[model samples]
Target: MTVLKAADELEEIVARVGPTAARLLTRGEEETMPEIAEALGMTEKAARARPTHYEHLDS
Candidate 1:
């Protein structure tokens, strides 16, 4: 499996999801979904949906 640990991988995520969402998705695992939503300036549902939506790209 490809691990997204490099800057270019993160930059790709940033390009696809915007900096806030990409940062939140990648670095905000300790935070709750509500907190992630707040940090990303999105609704909780949107925050929850982000992973499933983008996870396929990793494969």
Candidate 2:
């Protein structure tokens, strides 16, 4: 499998998923890495590690 460690790879993902979803929105329980990877043209692991896994830090 290919790794998306490079800036371009990450950028491609961000472009496809939108900045809010890509850089902020977290994946739901039903969502899997493979789904995102395929959409972003990245590897499952890479997509899983994406910053899209967002969480609310404040109450």
Candidate 3:
């Protein structure tokens, strides 16, 4: 998906889950995406496949 779409999705997730979603996105741990997805109740595929999707969270 495009960065725009990813950002939108990330924004929505953040809206639902609050700052923890952004914190997970910026985390430097191994398997961070999967951890973030699991924390947010999303599928691992949706998180791991598109790292840039959460760029807005970093900003």
Q: Evaluate all candidate structures by whole-model CA lDDT and list the values in order.
A: 0.68, 0.56, 0.62
**Count of residue pairs whose backbone atoms collide, per candidate:** 0, 0, 0
Best by TM-score: 1
Q: After superposition, how far is residue 43 of candidate 2 from its true place, in Å?
A: 0.8
Error of 1 at 46 (Å): 0.5
- Identify the superior model by TM-score, candidate 1 or candidate 2: 1
Please identify model 1 stretches exceeding 4 Å from their true place.
1-31
lDDT of 3 by residue, 4-59 (tens): 99999986876556545445555674557666778868887766544555444445
Displacement of the residue 24 alpha carbon in candidate 2, Å: 5.9
C-alpha-based local distance difference test score of model 2: 0.56
* Clash pairs detected, candidate 3: none
User: Quick one: how many clashes does candidate 3 have?
Assistant: 0
Better of 1 and 3 by TM-score: 1
Which parts of model 3 have CA positions greater than 4 angstroms off? 1-29, 56-59
- lDDT of each residue in 1-59, candidate 2, tens digit only: 25545777876665665645644435362365567678889987777666534222121
Residues 1-59, model 1: lDDT tens digits: 35656877887865566644544566656467788789889998887778766655544
